[model samples]
Target: MNKPLSILAVYIITAVSADESEPNIEEICRFVAPGTTILRPNTCEQWVRCPTAFGAADYDDGSCVYGLYFNKDTGRCESIENVNCPYESNIVKNRCASKKTGSFLPHPTNCKSYIYCQNGKEINATCPNNLIYHPTKVACVYAKQYECELKTFPANANPICKAIPKNKILADTKDCTKYYKCNKDQQLVKLECAEGQSFDYVSSKCVTQKSAICHPLAPELEPESDVCGNADNVHIGYIADEKSCSHYYICNKRANGRPDRKPLHLKCQNEHFFDINTWSCRDRLRVQCYLDRCEGIENGYVNVAGDCTAYAHCKNGVTIKRGKCGEGFNFDERLQICSQQNISYVACKS
Candidate 1:
C-alpha cells in the first residue's frame, strides 16, 4: 500500500520553494490592488530581500509570507505574500465592519481586533457611532467612546438608545445634596423634607397638615404686673391724663423736678408707676393718690378693705392673700373680694 504523504513533508517542501521567488518592491507594488496603499513589505522569504527603499519596510520580527522576507516601518510588521503583495502583520488598515456603509480607513488598536469606523468617518464613535466588534465578547457593543465629534454615528449600531436607559438620568440637587449621572444626560433631583420624608423634584415626600395652630409666643399681659391695663398708658408725666384719666406727674427728689405731664388717654383706677427715688410706691398721705387712692409700700399691699394691706401677695388666678395685718385672710374670686380680706374662701385655678 502507498503511504499517504505526511502533511508536514508537503509543508516543508512548499516552504523552501516559496523562498526562492522573493521579488523587489517594484514587483511587489504591482501585485497590490490598484489605488491600494502598501504600508509595509514582507521579509520572511530570503530571495525577496532588497535594499530598503523610500517608504520601504523596516526591521521585521520574524513575520514572513511564503518564505519572503520584509522590513518594518512605523512599528508595523512588514511581510510579503507569495513574493509580490505587501501586508502588515501587526495591524490591518480597514474600514468600519459594517458592509452596508463603506466606512473610512480604520487603524484598529489590536491587529486581530476589528473597530467600528462609521461611513468613512475617521472620528471616534459614541452610542450611535460605530461600535466595537470585540472578538471575545462575540457581539456588537455600544461604547461611550469620547471620540465622537458632535452627533455622527455608525449605521449598523446596536443597542440603539432607548430614552437613555432611564437608569442614567439623575435629578439636580441645588445643594449638590444628591444626584445621579446616566450614560445619557437625563436627571432627577431628590431631597429630605422637614417632616422626615424623602422628596423629589416632581413631588413632596411629606404631606403637610392643613389646620391652623396657636403660636406659643402670643402677646399677653405680664403675669407679674400688679395691674393689667393698656401698656401704653401706664407711665405718668409722659402724657396728660384725659379728664378722670389726667396724666399725673411724680416728683423725684433726686432727679431735679417733676416730669412735665402730657395729654394721654384715660387709664383704669388700679394702675402702677415705678418711683424713681423710693423705687416702690408708699401709702402715706403724701405718697397716696391725689384722688384719695391707696398705695403699695415695701412689704405693704393695698387691700380691698381700703386699708393699707402690707406685704399682700397674689397667687395664680389673682388669689390675693392679705398682709400680716389681716392674717388668716385671703381674697376669694367668688366673693369678689375687692374690699375685705376674707378667709374661708377658695380660689379656682385658671
Candidate 2:
C-alpha cells in the first residue's frame, strides 16, 4: 500500500490464510467476548472459546457445542473451561441395543453407567447409579421396579376372551329334578333319579309311583246274635234283641263292661249298620230272619192244629179220668155243652 504498510500495521486474516503465523489482535478481540457462539467453517469443528483466545465461541472438532465459557485469558482449550458441566466428559456412557430400539418393542436403553476412559482404556466402568438392566423390557430402570413378571400371570396370552352362549346347563343348576353331570361338550345331562323317589319333571316333586298297603286298621267281627264287642280288646260288641231291627255297638273300653253303659251304646239301625261296617245284607227274604235267633230259636216252633178246646173242671172228690168228666162226655168252656156220647173210652174205665 502506501509506502508498503509496516509489519506491525499489516492487517492479516489468519481464518482464511494457509500459513500458521501470528494471529491478528483485532480478530482475537472480536471473538473472545461473552455470549459468542461459532465454529470453524472448513472443518466444522467446535470449541467453547477462541483457539487463540479464551471465551470466544462454543465448539467441538469443528462442530459447535453448547456450554457456558469461563475466563477471558489464556487462549487454548485448557485455558477455557465449561462453567455448567456436572462431570468430566469421559465419565458418562450410553448403551443402545436392537431389542430396545425395535418397533415391535417401544422401550429404549438410555445412558446407563459412568465409564471413565483413559488412553483408550476403561477405568472404573460401573452400571448406572440407581438403576439396573431389565432383561424382559430391555431397558435400564430403577432397581426393584416391578413386583410381578408377565410369565407368572394366571392365564396364557394366546387365547382371546369371548362371550359364551346362554344354555340349559346354567339353568339346570338352579332347579334340576334329576342328578346332572356335565358332558364332554359342557352340556348338562341327567344321570338318574334320587334314592327312594322317582323324578317327575312336570310336578318337580319326588313321588312314589306305587305305595305299599298297611293292614286293615282295627277290624271287629262278632257272632250273628251278638252286637259288636271288642275282638282282641280292640273293638267292642254287645247282644241285640231278636225283634229289634237296629243293632248296638260300644267302642269305649271304660264303658264296655261298666254297669253305667248307657252312654257307650251307640244303637244304630240296620241302615246305619250297613254304613258303619260298609256291608250289605244278602238274604233278602226269610220269615225267621226277622228275628235274630239267639240259641235255640232256630229249632223253636209253636204247633196249632185246631180250634180252642174246653176246660174240664177237676174236683177233688170227682174221679177225673184223664182230666175228662166221663169217657165220651167232654165239657167245653167255649160252648159249655156235653154233646151226645160217642165212646172211645179207655181212660174212663178206672
Candidate 3:
C-alpha cells in the first residue's frame, strides 16, 4: 500500500507541470483586441493622447485638460482660430498653441517677396531690389543666377535686358534673314549675307556656292560628270585602243554649258578595262604578242634577202639590211639590188 501511494503522488506532480506549461489562448486573444493592441511581444497598451489639443475651445475651469490652454479672455482653451498657418502646428503645455514658422513660402506674383506664418500671423518679407527669392536655395540671390522663361518680344529685341557676351549671334524674331551680333560694348550690330550667298538657318552659316546638278550614272561613274562634264557622244562600251582593250574612253560634255560644246575624253589605265555596268575601271589580264616565224617581213622580224644568201631585218616598222653582202656581194633593200661587182660600194659592207 505504501508503494502505490508514492506512485500516485508522482503522477499528480507530472500532471500539474504539463498544465502549467500550456499557453493561455483566451489571454493572448484579449491582448490583441481593438483599442488595446499589443505594443510588443509581452506588452499590450493603447496610444496616449496629448493633454493639449490644437483648435480646441477654452474651458471655464482655470485648469486645462488634455494639455490644452485655458484662455481667460476667451474663456476657452487657446485654439488655432485666427492663425492662417500653411503648415502643421505644435501643441504646448501652455494654452497658447502656435504653428511652426520660418518656413519660407514664396509670393505667387512677386519673385522678391516671401511670406511665413508666425504666432498666428502672416509676416511678409522681401529680398534686395536686385535679388529674388530662390525656392530651392531657400534664400535671396542675384537675378542673374535665376534661369527665367523667355517672353515674346519684337524683332531684334534684347528681351534679356542683361549684358550678353561679345561676338554672340542673336536672331531677329520677325525676320529669318536678319540677325545681330553683340559687339564689345554689348551693343547689337546688324549683319547680312553676301551678294551670292544665303543664310542657312540650320547650319547657322552663309552658303556661298551651290551644288551642281548632274545626270545620274552607275555608282562608280556618278562623279565622272563632275570631273569630265557629261557623258554624251563617246562610244558607250568599246575599249580606247587596239593594242589592248583594257583602257577605255568616255566622252563628257564641256563645262561651258553650250549645246555645241565639245565633250571631254577620258580613259582607264593599262591594267584595267572599262566596265559598262559599273561605269568604272576593272582589272584584267594584259595581252601580249610573240612570234617564232617571219612572214611578209613583219615588224621586228629577220628574213632572207632576195639574193638568197643575204639576210635583212625589220626594225621599228622599217626594213634594214647589213651594210654589205656576205663575202662577195652588194645588197640594197630599196632597189632590190645585190651584186658581187659593186665591191667598192660605200653603202654596202667593205
Candidate 4:
C-alpha cells in the first residue's frame, strides 16, 4: 500500500511540472476583444482586429485570414489595395524628408561625407574640395589639416592668413593698450607678459615698460643741458646724436659742472643704427636708417679700396683698421661691398 501511494505522489508532481511549462490558451483568449484574432496558437499574446465575419471561434481555430494591416477606426483587417498611406508614414521616409531637407547630417563611416535618408533608403554625399562636413554645425567648413599660404601686411598691422608670423607685434583689437604676437604655427596668439612687463617692438622681446625712458612708438631723446647730478637730473637716458643722426648718446649727469654737462656718446657698429625696441644697434635690414653714409658700416668711413672689396672701421672719429672682404671676394661700394663676388680682389681697381 505504501509503494502505491509513493507512485501516486510521483505522478502528481510530474503533471504539475508539465502544466507550468505550457502556456494557458483559454486565459489569454479571454482577454482578447470580440472582433480581434490571435496572431498564433498557444502563444496568445499578439492580437489584431479581424474582418467582421471572423470572431473568437475562428480566431481559436486559426481559420481567420489577416491582411497587411488592421484598421482601429473600423475594427477590421485592411488589404494593401484598400489602405491609403503618406510617404512620410514610414520611419525611413519621414527621417529623409525632415533631416535631409532641413539640415546636413554627417555620415557614420566617413568624416568628409554626410548621410541623408530618402525614400526609405540612406544616401551619402561628400563636401566640396578639401572641406569637411560638420554634423553639429550642419555645414561644410574648411578642414583643419590643410595649410594655407601666408599673407603679407603693412607695418604694425594685423594678419589675414591663419598662420602666425614669428616675432611680430599687433595691437589688441579689444584693448588698444594691449598687444599680441604670433607663436610658431599658431596665428593671432595672445602674449601674456608678467606684471610690469610689456612687448618691445624694436627688440622683438618683452621688457619692463613702466619707468622705461622710451615708449614704443615715440621715444624721448636725452637732453644735453641738465647740470644737476644723480638719476633725477636725467630725463632721457639715450638720445640720437645731434652731430650725426645715425649715432646715439646716453645722458651722463655726473660729469663736469651743472648746465654744461655732456652725455656719453655712442655709435652703432657695422653701420647699424639705434633700435628703440632692443636698446642696441642692429643690422640695416633689421632696422631702418636714413643717412648719406653707407649702411652697415661706421659713420664717416669709406671702403678705401675703391673696388668695394674692403673698408676702414672708424672709432672716435678715426680709422682703426682696414677691413677686408672674405677670401675670393672683392668689396664694391656700388654692390654694397662683400655681398657678391662679381669682381676679383686682384683685378679690382683700388
Candidate 5:
C-alpha cells in the first residue's frame, strides 16, 4: 500500500491541535469512534488517529517510528515482534454505518463532496466550483487554504494512474461497462458499473443504455432493468436490486416513491449481499437474493421488488399501465402473460 513515508509516534486525535487546514486523517479513521486509534490495514508502522467525528470532519494522523508497529489491541505503537496486527474485519460494516450518521456526512473518498440528510431525505452534494469542503468548518473554503487530498486508496496502484489526477473517474476506452478511477496516490484503478448499465460520462454515473453514452470505441450495452415501480413497496425499505446480490436501494416509488422522492442507496462490499431475511447486509454465499429479473424489472411484468403479483407497463421509461394480474395468476416473463400452469405460476398460451 502507498502510505506516507514518515516517522512513528504516540497516537492522540483529541490532543492533536485543531487544524482547519489539514486533510482528514484517513478514510480508515471513519470506522472508529472519536478519540481512538485503529491500525491502518496492511501497514506495520503507520497508525491513524481518529477525530471525535464532530461535524463529520477532522482527524489526526501519526506514525510509529521506523522500528515500531501499530498495535490496535493496545492502541499504541509496539515493536514488530511484540505486535500482532491483524486486519479488523469490522471496518467495512462500521464504515457503512458511520456514513449514515448525522444530518451531513462527509464524502469518504471525495474531498469536495458531502451528503446532506434532512427529514429522511438524502442528497449528495458538492462544494461549489473553486471551493473545497472543509469538514470541521462545515462549509466550503478556498482550495489553497485547505491542505487535503481529494482521496486516498491505502492500497495498490497502476502505472496508468500516474497520468491522471486524484479522485478523477474516466470512462474506459474499450468497454462500456468498465471505468477507471484515479486514487489519491495518483494510482489508476479500473472499476465496473453495476450489471446492465454503462458508465455515463456526462453525468458521471452508471446509467441505462437508453441514456448512457460510452466511449467511442465501445459497443452499446443493454438497457437498465429496475424494480422500483410499485407504490406499496416504495418508500417501505431498502430492497435488493436485480443482477447484483450486493446492490440495494430504497427507491422513490411513483416518481419513484412518495412526494418526498428521497432514496437510500447502498451497495455492500467484500462480497456481502443485501439479506432480505434479516434486513441487513450478510455473506453473499449464505444468502440467496436478486436471483431473477422480475424482482426489479421496471417494464411489462413483475414490476416491483419482490412483488410477484404486480405488473407495470413502462412506456418511454414512464409507467403507464401497472397493476396486478387476475386473482389466480401472476405476471410471467417467459410468456409475457398472466397465467398459472405447470404449478410454476406459468403464463398461459392464447
Candidate 6:
C-alpha cells in the first residue's frame, strides 16, 4: 500500500494533516452518494462497499475468490482472463524498468503505493502508516502535503455531464448554490459556490445570494465522490505541489510524458525543501517560510495575510478562529475589532 497525503499545505513545517492519500475507509468512501461501491487503492482483488453514513462505519469490505479479480468497470469479481488488473500491473513494471536508478514511479492504481528504481533494480514500496511517498522530497509525509493529480469517478455510475460545450460553467435549475461545468472530457462536472453566495448568470461569478441568481438543483444529479475526476483540468505529469512547499509529484504534462517514466510522488530530502522561486527542492535554509500571519504576537485577533475584512482569533500565536467583517467593515489591527473607518485600505485587494 502507498502512504496517504492531504490537500491542505501550510508552510510552517507543521504536522502533516490532510488525508487524501490515506487508505482509511472514510476518505475512500467520500463524495459519492451513500451505498456506492468503490475500489480499495492499489489492489483489484478487494472492494469496499461505501456506507450511507459518513466515514468508516456502515461499510462492507470484500475480496475476490482465488483466480478472480474485482473489476470495477464490471462491478464484480471476475476471472483473470476477464479483468485488466494483471495487465495494469505489467504496465507499471514495464514503466519502471527503463527509468534511471533512484527514480521513483507512481503506482497507476494506488495513490498510497509507489515504485522505487535504484541501482538498476525496481522495487515496490509503501509509505509507513498514512504517510505518502513524495517523489520530489523523495520521502514519506502527511496527506496535506500532496494532491493526487488523478481524477476518480464511479466505475458504474451514469455520466453526470450534460449536452453542453466543454469548459463552460452552467447554472443549475435545482440548487442556487451549485453549478455545473463541462470538463475537457465533456463530462458534466458539478461545483458548489462559496458560503452565502450563489452562481449568478448575470455577472458570471459567485456573488451574494441576494444579488445573484439561483436555481434549484435536480435530484437526479448525484454527488461526485471524486471531485478531481470531474475537474476541468489537472496537472498531468511530474508536477510541483502548489499546496505544499516541501512536497512535489510527477504529473508531467503528457501524463507519463516519458515512456521510461511514470507519475510518482517525491519530496525534498532531509534538511531540504521545495523552493517556489526555483521550483524544486533545495537546501532547507534556502527556503525560508515567513507566511504565518500570526508569527510572533502572543495573543488576540490579528488581520489575515491579505484580506482587510478577514481576521483570525489567535491564542499563543496560533489561530483558533477565523472570520470576515461585514461589508464596509475592516479589521482594526490595533483594536482587534472590525471597524468601518479603514474601508478604503488599499492593501486588502489581495
Top candidate, metric TM-score: 6
Error of 2 at 295 (Å): 99
Q: Residue by residue across 1-350, what tens digits does model 5's lDDT show?
A: 12331210111111122221222344323222345555454454566655664224555667877546566556677644344433221122122222333556566557788767554445678998878777677788898888755333233233222212234465555578877665454344568986446787544578866678675545655443345543344345566666566777775434323322334667877545577667787654345443432323355443334455555565543456667777877666456676664323211111
TM-scores for every candidate against the unseen true structure = 0.17, 0.13, 0.17, 0.18, 0.23, 0.25
| RMSD in Å for all candidates | 32.3, 48.8, 34.5, 35.4, 25.7, 27.2
Error of 3 at 112 (Å): 5.1
Off by over 4 Å in 4: 1-234, 252-260, 295-350
Local distance difference test scores for all models: 0.28, 0.27, 0.35, 0.41, 0.50, 0.53
Clashes of 2: 18
Q: Top model by lDDT, which number?
A: 6
Query: Which is superior by lDDT, 1 or 4?
Result: 4
1 versus 5: better lDDT goes to: 5
Instruction: List model 1 lDDT by residue over 1-350, tens digit each.
Output: 12232322232123223223322334332212122222232322222222233224442223333323332222223322112122223233223322335332222342223344455333443223456443345444555432312222122111111111223222222221232222232112233333212223222122221221111121221212112222243433323222222123332221323222222223323344322244343222223232212232233233333333232354432325544344544444233343355333111111
For residues 25-44, write the lDDT of model 3, one tens digit per residue.
22211111112111111111
lDDT comparing candidate 2 with the true structure: 0.27
> In candidate 5, residue 255 scores what lDDT?
39
What C-alpha lDDT, on a 0 to 100 scale, does residue 118 get in candidate 3? 72
Q: After the best TM-score superposition of candidate 3, give how far the Cα of residue 47 lies from its true spot, in angstroms.
A: 56
Q: Ten residues in a row with the worst lDDT in model 4?
A: 156-165
By the TM-score metric, which is better: model 4 or model 6? 6
User: Order the candidates by TM-score, highest first — what do you get?
Assistant: 6, 5, 4, 3, 1, 2
Instruction: Give model 1 RMSD, 1 decimal.
Output: 32.3
lDDT by residue for model 4 over 221-256, one digit each (tens)? 233333223343443466665445357767544343
Q: Give Cα distance to truth, residue 33, candidate 1, Å.
A: 65
Say which prediction, candidate 3 or candidate 6, comes out ahead on lDDT. Answer: 6
Candidate 4 lands at a TM-score of 0.18
